[model samples]
Every structure is written in C-alpha cells, then in structure tokens.
Target: MLTSPVDDEPPLTGKMQPTNVVVLGASGSIGEASLDVLSHLPPKRWQAWGVSAHRQLGELSQRLFATGLRPRFIVASDPDSASMAQGMPWPKGSELLFGGDALVDLATHPQCDTLIAAIVGRAGLESTLAAVQAGKRVGLANKEALVVGGCLVCEARQVSGAELIPVDSEHSAIFQCIQGSSSPPRSLILTASGGPFRTSTGEQMRQASVADALAHPTWQMGRKISIDSATMMNKALEIIEARWLFDVPPSKIQVMIHPQSVIHSMVEFVDGSVLAQLSPPDMRLPVQYAITYPERLECPVSRLDTLSRYDWEMLPADPERFPALTLGFEVAAAGGTAGAVLNAANEAAVQLFLDGEIRFTEIVPACRSALENHHFEQHPTLQRLLEVDRWARAEVQRWHSGTRA
Candidate 1:
C-alpha cells in the first residue's frame, strides 16, 4: 500500500524541505514496500501528496486508513476499483480521482513535485509521460514507459529537462556506480537471479506449472513481473530500459546470471577497472535512494555488515536457456517501434500464460512472432507506436487463440 508520511511530521526549517511525492500503482508490492521506506524518512524530508491504485481497492483503503493521512486526492485508475474505493471509508476531506485522465491530472498537479511511476506495463506510459512533460522529478518504477515509449520519454526529457531516477535496482545500481563520472562507461553489466528455473531444463520449463514459474528465487513481485523474471523477460525489458536510461548502444549492455542476486549491476570503464553497487536484496534501498537522490537517507532496513562471508557467484546469461533475455537485446539493437511491438506482445503473452490459455514456453516465442510479423517502423511517431502496440497485442491474442495466419 502507498503512504502519506507527511501527516505526523512538522516542517523543516533550513535546507531540509520534503519531497512532495505522488505514487502511481499504490496497491502493488512496490507500493507496499515504498510505504515502509517513506515512513522512515525524517519527517521533513518526504511528503506523499497523492496515490493511485488500479485494483485492490480494499487493501488500498486499509493501508490509507493506517497512515491517518487525508491526502489531497486518491486515484482509482480502474472503473470497478474506483467504484469500490469510493464506498470505502476515507480520511475526512479526502477527494477521489478516477480513471487514466485523473492519473494524468495528478501527475501534472502543481503540488506533486516528485512522481513514483509504478503503474506497470504499457498502461503506465501516459501518466509517466505527463509527469515528464510537467518536469516532475520522476522515480521510475514502471519499465513499460521506457520500453514502449523510450523515444517519447527521451524527447520529453530533452525538452523539459525532467530528472528520471530509476527505481529499478539494476538501473539504480548502474546510476550509483557511474556517479561522479564525466564520461560514459565502456559497458554495463546487469545481473539476474536466474529465477526459479535457472537450473531447469527446456523440457522442464515447457512443462512448468504456473505456480512453478511464479516461484522466483528472490524478489517478491507482482504476478506479471514474477513470471517475466521466471522467463528472463524482465531482464530483457531492463536491457532496453538501460539502453535508453544510460544512452548506450545495445552492444555495450550485457546480462549475467548471478543466482545469488547480491550484486545488483556492474559498470566497466574504458580502462580495466570495474565498479559495482552492493546491497542486501532490498527494493526499499533503491526506492529510498531515488526519493532522496544525491543523498542517502537513513533507511529502516540495515545492510549486511559481513561482506566477506558469502561468496559472490556470477555466470554468463545462457540465451539458449532463456530466450526472453535475447528479445530485450534484439529490441534494444532494433530500437524505434520494435520495442513497442515486442513489449505489447510480451504483455499479452504473459497475461495469457497466467490465465492458463497458453503454455509457459510459448510466451517468448509469441513475442518474437509478433515482432517479426509487424510492419517495421524505423522512426515512429507516438501515434504510430500506439498503433503498433495495439496491432501487436491483437496479433498475440489471435495467435494465442490459434486464429492468426
């Protein structure tokens, strides 16, 4: 659940103003984790002005009740969830915001200076874009915005000079390691957990159960992301995100299978030296880091003091073992609307796989098929990208249903 940590705290006097934050997808695991992080901030350092939840209205309301914060507004981005949350007890003087437009409105709200864009999938693109256009400091929790709308996002940042701090661990790791550096690194290395299927064979993965796929070795995540991790597609999308976030060519970004999941990511300089960011496998560290950028705040969660006890394990990403990782590199290399098509197809395929409508192994192949079949657009306008997004989703659905040519 999301939080409004500003309620109990008194104002800061000198050089310590709070960040006025708006959280999108306020009911997910990330939202829940962010609440914990926000609660620990020195009262004067953070203020959650608004929050938007797409589903789980009951849970959202319960969490909101605990905070005793009557926010400026709360958004239910889903119609049914909106109706449900409206009936739930809210703090006095609280106003309700509904639908995508409401989310956009809040993103552009003058009071909201920081945005935690966590609304998942392509659904998160518009509000994220809105935050960027409004020049809000964006702590990006949504990968789809960068994956499907990287070009649009890049253009907006160039025009508005909006700051995008990645909430994803991998990107944040790279961001931290590269700090104080004037030049770009020679290459980037993103680490993966190898997921639950890291050691499973292709036949075993093909026959893997939905429950099996969701059993991630590390990282408690929502269903879609957990499944994506199981298939290594999350890494793929992050590869694309890193390409845009860091302004690097696809060849410079590499993925390594680190089953321990200790080292978030690494950076290799032009020289022989390499730098890496180490933290306990905690999402709040990065989330807090993004919120309190340029300054690391005292977090509720402490770090592992014994650094030399555990051995670090790292291995090359086996493309044959996890084809989803390949898709990200492919999309990164291709750029343009190819990312939109690939991401849309993967979104559809993952949903279908979750619903038991498609086999576990079919998800990546389905995305590849959609990418290959789409009319390639080297340079696409936002409208063209949206058109391709819709086309790819439809094609994935038809193909999943055995209705496509």
Candidate 2:
C-alpha cells in the first residue's frame, strides 16, 4: 500500500473552493473521459484551469465547446498545430501557449491545484514530473512516467509532498481496497481483459493485423494503447508502475486474466483474505475517484445490473502466449535502464507493426532484444534514462532493418 502522508489530507468537497485542474493530453481517450468526469461534477467545486493537445487542436476545440469549459490555459504542444490555432475559436479569457515547455509551465503553475497527466508514451514524463515536484495533487494516467522514471518521481513526491493518485482503473481499484487497512497487504493482484486475441490461437496472433490488435474487447483506447493491450505489454507496464506506486516488491505483485473486466483489481491480506473492487468497465468511475478521492460522488456512468444474471471468469495468464508479461516482471525487478529500454523498444515495435514493417509477434522479441542489450544501471538520473530510451528506440529500428550484428 502507499505510505505517503499526503493521503491524510481532507477530500475535495463541494464546500471547499473550486479545485483548479490541468488536463494534459486533453485530446486522448483518457483526457476525453476526464473532461466528461469534470463536466458532470459540480462546477462550483471543480474547474478546468488548463487543457493541452499535441496535434488535435480541432478535437480539443470541439471537446472544450461541448463541455462548455473555458479553461484559463490552452496549450498546443506541436508547433504545426500552434500555427493553425491563431484563428481557432478558443474560449474567451483563455491564454494560448505553444510548445512542450508550456506543458511543464502549466503543470507547475501556482493555480494548478491538480493535474491530470493523460499524455501517452514518454512524451508526458517531464510535465508529470514537474507537477509532482511542484506539490500538486496528480491524477496519474500516464503509467509510462512511472515505468520509465519511477525512482525520480517517487523521490520528488517525498521531497515536495505531492499526492500521486492513480487514474488507471486497476491501480485505482487496488488503492481503494487498501484504504484504512489495519495491516500491509500480502500481495497486489491486477486483473486484465486479455485483449482481442485472448481466445485466439498463437498462430492467429502471429498473423494479427493492425485492425485486429486495435479491436479491444472491453476498452476503447488510442492506437498505441490498443496495440499494447493486444500484446499484453500494457499490463506489463502496469506491473512496473505498481511496483513503484505501492512501494512493493515485484514478488508481491501478481496479474490475473479476468475476461469480465468487472473485478478491476484485488489486495490480499496477510490472513489469507482478499479485498476486490468490482465496477462496470468504466474509466469515468476511476477518473472521478481520482479527482474527488476519499469522497465518493454520484457518477454519470451506468451502474452494474445486479438484478440480471451475469457470469464472471478468472484465469491464470499464459506466459507462453503473452511473452510481454515476462518482460514486465523482469523490468519491474531490474528497476533502472531496463524500464526505459523496454518501454521505448515496445513503443517503437508497436509503431513498426502498425506501419506494416513487422509482424505483431515480433514486438515482444524486439523489446526483449533491446532490454538484454542495454547497459544495466542500478541507479540512473533522469538524463541517463532519457538517453537509454533514445538508444533503445534506435536499436529496435536497427534490428528491424537487419543492420545490428
């Protein structure tokens, strides 16, 4: 369980002043869910102070208009997108900023009481770190930040007293189950939906197309994430994240295949009891919880139909089918340059697969090759980690091109 003292703070309630939130990667799926969650919340209790989009200025504008949120800051992280934003119908009283540096600026801004880090891939790391260093309550959806640089983020949290609340449904479920516990949990159990290829044979996955990989059974996510899910690398990254988030060893963390996606996650006690959080597979529930933690609010998501008959299934994940799970455990235990290399290599390989350069089955092998080839550093600075990330991506490219010895 999390040992941070920041959890003791009073929950954000209606009686308190409106909490200003900055949603980074406001163009992505998680960001869209966050906007919906904010829109449904009482306006007097919460405000969208800032929002950012990398290349989807149009989509971001549409979301802003639909939600009727006039955030104080609108950031266009891509230069090309910022150039076209000169004539966009931005909300009045909103200051428009350009470039990636502005994201870090808004994250550490004084008015930012909370920041929702939803940016995908390694692009979200700097701003997410900036928010934690500035002592803001962070709703962390960008698991890559913790996967690549968990040590730095955890260390900064200790120094700045930031509250790192999870927005991922699985981690959020684990956080909820461990609350007010009398003793430390014996193990943390994370559940997976097994992606679209769960029931398919190994040969089917080897021949899977981009469309097949993106067809997630239970969740609607962006392209990169959908590919990760298909390969079970998303769960692998989450394993690395859980190791740092809860301050637990990799040996104490476990993953189970739950096709229903109802039981998000579980916590096992020392006395042989398990506490699980079951909810409909809705991201809004966890997003709302991260925003108004320790205080449950009426969410807009539909409730589970307890009156109807339902079947739930839990099975052991097959290591033979999902090789990425082994890589996840290896990175979680190795803890340094290994994570940066695995994440970058996986990202590059996924992109290669999507672009028709490699087979879906080649992704995990590429990640493993990069992880084994990278120099093992027990303790690495942020700069060193970034260097490893770049090196791993290049290595994957070289490996695909048959240039590496």
Quick one: best lDDT, which candidate? 2
Worst 10 residues of 1 by lDDT: 1-10
What tens-digit string does per-residue lDDT give for candidate 1 at 260-355? Answer: 877999999988679999888888888889899999867876677784678779999999889888889999999989999999999999998998
TM-score of each candidate structure, all chains considered together: 0.94, 0.95
What TM value does model 1 have? 0.94
Highest TM-score against the true fold, candidate: 2
Cα distance off (Å), candidate 2, residue 292: 0.5
lDDT of 2: 0.92
Candidate 2 lDDT, 91-116, residue by residue in tens: 88887888898899889876679999
Name the weakest run of 10 consecutive residues (lDDT summed) in model 2.
1-10
Model 1 lDDT, residue 157, Cα: 93
